[model samples]
Target: MQDLLGHLRSGQVCYSTPQGAMISGDSLELLAQLPANSVDLFVTSPPFPLLRQKAYGNEDQQRYVAWLTEFAKLAKDALKPTGSLVIDIGGAYQRGLPVRSLHQYRALLAFVDDVGYRLAEEFYWYNPSKLPSPIEWVNKRKIRAKDAVNTVWWLSKTDDPKADVGKVRVPYSKSMERLLQDPQRYYTPKDRPSQHSIGEAFGRDNGGALPSNLLSIPNSQSNDAYLRACKALGLSGHPARFPIKLPSFFIEMCTDPGDLVVDFFGGSNTTGRAAEDLRRRWLSFELDRAYAAESVVRFIGDQAPAKVLKHIEQMTNGQVLAIDDSA
Candidate 1:
């Protein structure tokens, strides 16, 4: 069959090196082709069904959920018993009415539950720049809401999923330090402090504290940190990108060196970049050929110590990482 992307736009695979891999095709179909129980981590944000219009888009809400469900099952079967699935999904808005995002979650949760995958934990990637919602004034009463965040649902197949929370943990404020001193104080802990939360806290020194779910990292579109990190790594910009710190934190928290990381959507290849920077092997898939080409360029440019494509040639074999998956 003719490649959909090929007919629309030329698609190219990049970085045959073990450190990076990219493919151009339908994400769901591509994911199906992957080996089962192969990846250690799967991180991605599938396009939301809200803005239901695209050139080559399949943005129908029910269809989107169904599509995701089919792959979710395959992902469950393909993931290592300990592998983690990190998904980011946007909520919905319609005709001045606020829509609950749980629909996506509900459909996804059903599959994960049916597969018997354990609900390990979840993270909220708060977008502080999100637009505010409208309010209705009824007989002097008022209501106001903001579109300020997206949820990062972290899932695992087993109860003891692999996570090095230290990777995601940020530092405590001076006030937190002073407050912790008084163990008996009745304070509402610092908006979910890292170590204070009931989860794995990786990267903490003897004196360092854990991080909170209310992450302060803005999306890469608005944050210079991603560009800075990419520049330091020797790559260019990817607009639909997440800060390296986000994925880097996950690498630190859930994975070790020589582990395998996969990002099916692979939008800007942020996940793969993070994996390589941390000394782990990565494989990514993107339906958009243009983005896939950019991923390769970015990977090679940043991974090579010098501006030499020859260095990428040195990478042949990829190390494999393992994860736990449940029903």
Candidate 2:
């Protein structure tokens, strides 16, 4: 169980705290520099393949699958045999058409069929609070409904990726709990309409209720430190920021304390923060220097007058905040 903190090398170091470091460079380059089989988990939200170009980095539909395929090889090379790669890719439209883009599906297939990674499991992140998008289609034309879900693909280098369901279990319903006390009285062990047998011990509490693959985690973070800092400093917010809970679920289930986690696409550095808060060693890479510099604010927990002021001081370092940031 050797720690890979010192082992990570590459890119311009924006800043480093005791928890982890964020590299200011291309993620693929950083992936190449890391030793083979060094990372325990690769959880990231890469630039989604959108129909329209986004201010934040994202690939166009025509070349998205091929584009993402290249990174799959690099990511596979860096992951340990027991490691998992959890990706959160958003849904996209077909520009003028009322159809949805299948790049997300195609990219998943490419990662598995081409890159030699196994499909660990598929999870969906349902953002209940998502605003309506694609004004022409969803809002104006009234053809499509609000796109609120993102596909979280869990791809593993090996068949047996390190995941414990017990760690990420949810609470059970009151009726379900009551039935566990006396199974025979409440329900009989018989076949149902769907021909699925209802076993007597079905209600057994294995810690808590198993979580569904359709995760209902709303992506709302108005009072969060990272967003707050970005706004006050006039640094444009990383538009596509996933909630902390999304990464938190996968990290706890797939990794242990001191396990090495990497976020190749460090936009808001949410994955790194989640890993650090959970005591997992992490490394992050972002091509944008400003975004990378702003990411440091998420790491600092020292006493400051205001959180925004703290972020500005940390970003500036009281000067131009210049360094040999090129890795």
Error of 1 at 74 (Å): 1.4
Off by over 4 Å in 2: 1-9, 178-188, 223-225, 232-235, 305-327
lDDT of 2 by residue, 1-327 (tens): 124534545576666655577767777778887889888998898898876678877988899889878877899998999999999989888888888999989999999988899999999999998889988888998988999999999999998999998899998888877787776677777898999887856867787888989999877666467777666566666777888888999999999998888998898889988998898888888887767777665655332437645454565442223222231
lDDT of 1 at 10: 29
All models: lDDT?
0.60, 0.80
TM-scores, each model vs. reference: 0.70, 0.87
Which residue ranges in model 1 land beyond 4 Å of their true spot? 1-12, 52-58, 133-144, 177-205, 220-239, 300-327
